[model samples]
Target: MNQVWLRVAQLEDADAIAQLVNRAFQVERFFIEGDRINPGAVRELLRKGKFLLAEQSGALAGCVYLEPHGDRCYLGLLSVDPGRQRSGLGTLLMGAAEEDCRAAGARGIDLQIVSLRTELPGYYRRLGYEENGTAPFPASAQPKQPCYFIRMSKELG
Candidate 1:
């Protein structure tokens, strides 16, 4: 594997980020019926938050979204190429997100995962996040099965 490089996403990266995000989120097809995001949505997100992209060999390997809200930062859309799922790219992106939040004077980070993805809580847990609460999944999503959001948080040192 080539050395993975990290950078802040730019508006011009919308299409690539959208494509990479959809490809990485294909696993959600079991529950969700469409792409996790489109370029337009990514563009909108860019206006509110920043995405940290991980590239390997000139291709996007992973990305994570970070949005600072005063003392807490919201983290989301953590995606890693399916082929690179266990390669530590996700962890690397997460660390980058945390560092960025910490640098911004955030006291903690918050994120949410689909409850149906039972494996996700543990993944975030390993990174020092704890289940803080839950939220109703959007009705518009029309998931194949019942699901909700599991909110998690990690306080920065």
Candidate 2:
């Protein structure tokens, strides 16, 4: 396995982050329309929380967003570079995000996956997260097929 350096993203990384996220989220194109996020959105999110990034050979390999909310943290956008998917980068990023949440005094982490992504729940479950509930898919997403969000959460030990 190659060494991957982890760090909190900076403002200048917005473009790269957006590109990486868009590429990683292309799998959702079957149901969702367009890119997952833009550089402006990435900058806005930077103000609310932090993006934990994984770099391999100084290139973005993966990223996960962590927004601490009271005693719980909202985790999202766990993106692993498509070319690097299944290389354990997603798991690596998730572990780092969970640790960051714990250090920030969060009791648990919450995340949601599109209902159309039938493979997600099992992947998250392997990381100790359980299905909590569901949320309506944003109308703005303009999904091609009917879908909702499957909310999942994990309590930090």
Candidate 3:
């Protein structure tokens, strides 16, 4: 496999990021309404956070969004191209996000996974994130049924 490169995303990457996210999240069809993200929403998020993109041979392979808040950073929309899933790209993106957050003075990182995605909590746990609590799903999420977000966090060393 070719080396995967990482870079900070610019506004121009919003569309490609949105498409990658939506494609990666198509599995949500079992639980949520609509796509994972749209270009306009990604643009809005870009204003408040930074996106780290993973590329292989100059093609977008995956991405994650990081938003700093006080002592912690919020990580979300972790997307890996369906073709690249399980190839360790997601893990690489996560490590890079944590490093960036720590460099920015954050002591921890937090993320919310939809409760219905039963496999996610365990996956995150293996990545060192602990289940902190649950919160109502964001209104913008448009869940297909009653759903909540399982809040998870990991402390940075």
Tens digits of per-residue lDDT for model 1 on 135-157?
99998999999999999999998
- Give the per-residue lDDT digits (tens) of candidate 2, residues 61-120: 999998888889999999999988998999999999988998888999999999999999
Worst 10 residues of 1 by lDDT: 62-71
Top model number, TM-score: 2
Cα displacement (angstroms), candidate 2, residue 114, comes to 0.4
RMSD to the hidden true structure, all candidates: 0.8, 0.7, 1.3
Steric clash pairs (candidate 1): none
Ten-residue segment with the worst summed lDDT in candidate 3? 137-146
Per-residue C-alpha lDDT of model 3 across residues 1-157, encoded as one tens digit per residue = 5699999999999999999999999999987867878999999999999999999988999999999988899999999999989889998999999999999999999999988899898888989999989998877767777889899999997
A best-first ranking of the candidates according to their TM-score comes to 2, 1, 3
TM-score, one value per model: 0.97, 0.98, 0.95
Cα error of candidate 1 at position 145, Å: 0.6
Q: RMSD to the native, candidate 2? A: 0.7
lDDT of 2 at 65: 93
Candidate 2's C-alpha runs over 4 A off are none
**Better candidate by TM-score, 1 or 2:** 2
